[model samples]
Target: MKYLMPFLGLVALLACRGKNVEGKNMGKEIVEIKKENTSQGVDTLSQEPRLKTFKGLADTTFVRLADFSDGFAFDLRYATENNFLKAKVYDCAECYTRVKTAKALIAANKDFLDKGVKIKFYDCYRPNSVQYKMWEIVPNPQYVANPDKGSIHNKGGAVDITLVDMQGNELDMGTDFDYFGKRAYHDNTDLPEEILANRKLLKETMESHGFWSIRTEWWHYNLSAASNDKVANFKWECND
Candidate 1:
């Protein structure tokens, strides 16, 4: 919702207090809204976070996902020592994506929510510098992208993610994030029915949103239109 300035004088706007003038509001109420009352929309002034708007942001701008919506969960393994690298490389645990990627993710997540699950991000928008660190640990180009050319992650258009129930329990997708084996391959359908179903759900949903998964990693996805985008080392500021 927009925080509209009272353009007309108090007496003029008295009866139309909760209305929009033609030159004023974008069809929303032109009144002060209590932050607590906004259960389903963005509230920029609220101490409690409401979903934020992407009004003025560029499509290429990097943004924190948390600032947009509280509908998703994050378990950033790279920020901790839990990833395959077994090294903590990030300054903090935060999920960011390019505006286009973020928009696509948000749309896909809404679809997931309708299926009683939501998107849980493991990694998003890795810095090119972090790509170098990952390459140092695992020099294999197959497993880790060479930092010189940079990965889609460095371009802010790739993410490692999974599905979680509303209760925050993960859907079993055969292998954990970053599992480097045939078991992790998307083509490995020899697994149980439940696992294949989970993988199918994730793959189809993401693909519908302009994302494509790599054959080796069921959890990895790249925004189809963002592959040729330039790599960036845009680091986010961590709160104290």
Candidate 2:
């Protein structure tokens, strides 16, 4: 029986692999993209189990984006006291989004990586409970969305992000994330050309991947398909 078990395990391992979703440069494939820095000539790719974990997940299922690809970066401000709330509401720093939103993010990251940059997340998939917490900190509808009427973040469809060069340096977007002012508005054009260019890159690429940007926050994006998803209260457990 011991020998049979080993043989069966080997068969299972073999059967679990070998399905490669061929990727192209325009961002169709998820983990198969071997991004080469257009200027520096650097590249990366990995065919690991994590990349296939989404195979059977429903599009509406909330998932950790990192589980599917290592092509992006995260800051997760709300996990720390760096955000506008000036409070650490989340117990841990993790980025989760609905499967559909995640796929769009992965596709957007692929395009960003090709441009020698990647998306750095500030926030993703906030629990509706956290929304109430944020609202308690700032009840104004101008900044914090009313928890009574859940925001897109609670729906696992919104992301607060910015671009980081391959060197892990954030691009100059004219203002830090969660900044509340005219400077952060998407229509605010009184900025330097470089800053505008950087924002343009992040905006246009995300738009191409089915995300729409809000008028007031350049860092915010919402998946058009996830607008109607129910507000989720699933809290993440911190691993010791």
Query: Which candidate comes out best when scored by lDDT?
Result: 1
Give the whole-model CA lDDT for all candidates, comma-separated: 0.91, 0.89
For model 2, residues 1-240, the per-residue Cα lDDT tens digits are: 979999999887776663332224335543334433423444443333535567888999988888888888999999999988889999999999999999999998989999999999999999999999999888999998888889999999999999999999999999999998999999999999999999999999999999999998999999999998898898877887
Count clashing pairs, candidate 1.
0
lDDT (10s digit) by residue, model 1, range 127-219: 999999998899999899999999999999999999999999999998899999999999998999999999999999999999999999999
| Cα-lDDT of candidate 1 | 0.91
Count of steric clashes across candidates, in order: 0, 0
Candidate 1: 10-residue stretch with minimal lDDT: 27-36
In candidate 2, residue 73 scores what lDDT? 90
Clashing pairs in 2: none
User: Candidate 2: how large is its RMSD?
Assistant: 15.6
Candidate RMSDs in order: 13.3, 15.6
Q: Indicate the residue-level lDDT of 231 in model 1.
A: 98
Candidate 2 lDDT score at position 137: 88
